[model samples]
Target: MLVLGIESSCDETGIALYCTRRGLLAHALHTQMAMHAEYGGVVPELASRDHIRRLVPLTQSCLKDAGADFADIDAVAYTQGPGLGGALLAGASYANALAFALDKPVLPLHHLEGHLLSPLLTDEGVDFPFVALLVSGGHTQFMAVHGVGDYVLLGETVDDAAGEAFDKTAKLLGLPYPGGAKLSELAELGTPDAYRFPRPMLHSGDLNMSFSGLKTAVLTAVEKARAEHGGSLPESVRNDICRAFQDAVADVLAAKAAAALRQTGLRTLVVAGGVGANRQLRQRLCALTIGKEAVQTFFPPPALCTDNGAMMAFAGAMRLRHGVQAAAPAGAFTVRPRWPLAQLSP
Candidate 1:
């Protein structure tokens, strides 16, 4: 089966083609980071408009790269929700319209599910019945994955996702928009233990976590540093703070991942979402061990770490391969901007 996947959940427009027999054929993406950076964050209206502009050209590019035509598509899969409503609508409407033109079935996929299943796109042999740590800009949660479409909520953030905290903390430290990645880059130059930050909910005796308190702790430290430096934070001090903040997040996530593995008696840990690309977090997760058994961690390729069409395509193919029903037709469709991963039916 040939499936075309469209992803416009937020600031990126991604399009791809996947074949059950050939794996991912080709994928194209256009990120609005540079545009959104000028505004300090994404403007939903702009994001939606960009998606509308990029979808057709990107799809054509993907098809050209794949050496396929639109007529070859057997099914169309697209992110249905859990994102900016306008952004989701842009992709959904385009996908439905295209599928209707081609007379192909449509698959309304969950955005988080696309991320959760992305590791399978690689050749590393990630299997089912594993614990998934889905950490991204919008969400941070642990899930118990029994199989495709069978996911159980393990734990999640009570407030402020890890990536959100990273960006917010970076902004507090005078970094630019989309500060999470920049903060991580600076962390590499920082001194360990120079300015330790709090690890919120590290020992709450449950899987649920919190990062809002950690962000406040960083704010407090930043204020103190600025006050001591005559209202200006030194570059070295900023890097040290970044290191401490990254370390704190890495430590807490590592500990919780281990606990989840132990609780479920699962050794495979699949890390997904943008934060899965973090150097410190990857190091911590790679070295994770529960009791005497070492945990096996899987991550999508760096390019696939962020939102993209390939994950959606691959996920849709997997569902179809497993006999999940596709939408009857693309006559009338709607987007769900706030759909939960747990709401998916097995």
Candidate 2:
């Protein structure tokens, strides 16, 4: 079976074809990151408009890349929600319209499910039941995934995702918009002990984290540094602060991930979402995976770390290969912009 996946939940419009017999055949993506960068964040209306414009061309490109025609797709899968409503609608409408025209089944997939299942695309050897740390621009959470659609909520952020903190802090420090990656790069040139930032809820005895306070702490530190440095934060000082902030986040996540792994007694840890792209976080995770102990960690390739259609398509293939079918058709569809992964039926 072959599934064509469509994703337009936010700044990216992605289309892909996943073949059950062969894995990912081809994928195409159109990122509006540069457009949203100018605004320091995404504008939902503009995102929706761009998806509408890119969906068809991207789908065509994906099919052409696969050397397949539209008639070859056995099903159409699309991100159903847990994102901007208009953006979701753009993908949903396009997917449904195409499915209706093609007489193919439509799989309305959960976006987090897409992220959670993305690891399977990389590690074909990975099995069910593992700890998942999904850190993205909009979400930060720990989950215990047992199998397809079998996810248990371990913990999540009370406020401000890790990526959001990175971007906001970078902006305050006069870095470019969409500053998460840039901030991480600057952090590499900084000395670790030059500054220190707080680790929020490191000892709360649960999985829930709070990053909003950390960003405020950074703001306070930035203010003090500017005042002390003749009204402006110096380059070295800014880099040091960025390093400190990055370390703080990495420290808390590593601690929480260790706890999650221990609590579940699961040796495998899967990290997903945009923040999973941070080199510092990857370095920290790499260190943890080096021991002779029974723990291993996995992260998607940098491109797959963000929201994309390929994950959705790949996830749909998993569901189909495992005979996991959606209960409703296009006529009976519903979008859950705030759906919880633990609420999904396995």
Which candidate has the top score in TM-score? 1
**RMSD of candidates 1 onward, in order:** 0.8, 1.5
Worst 10 residues of 1 by lDDT: 322-331
Which tens-of-lDDT digit does each residue in 219-264 have in candidate 1? 9999999999899999999999999999999999999999899999
Segments of candidate 1 deviating more than 4 angstroms: none
- The 10-residue segment of model 2 with minimum total lDDT is 325-334
TM-scores, all models, native as reference: 0.99, 0.97
State in Å the error of residue 166, model 1.
0.7
Q: Cα deviation of 186 in candidate 2 (Å)?
A: 0.4
| Local accuracy by lDDT, each model | 0.93, 0.88
Candidate 2 residue lDDT tens string, 127-195: 878899999988999999888877899999999999998899889888988888899999999998798
Clashes of 1: 0
Superposition-based RMSD of candidate 2 using all C-alpha atoms, in angstroms: 1.5
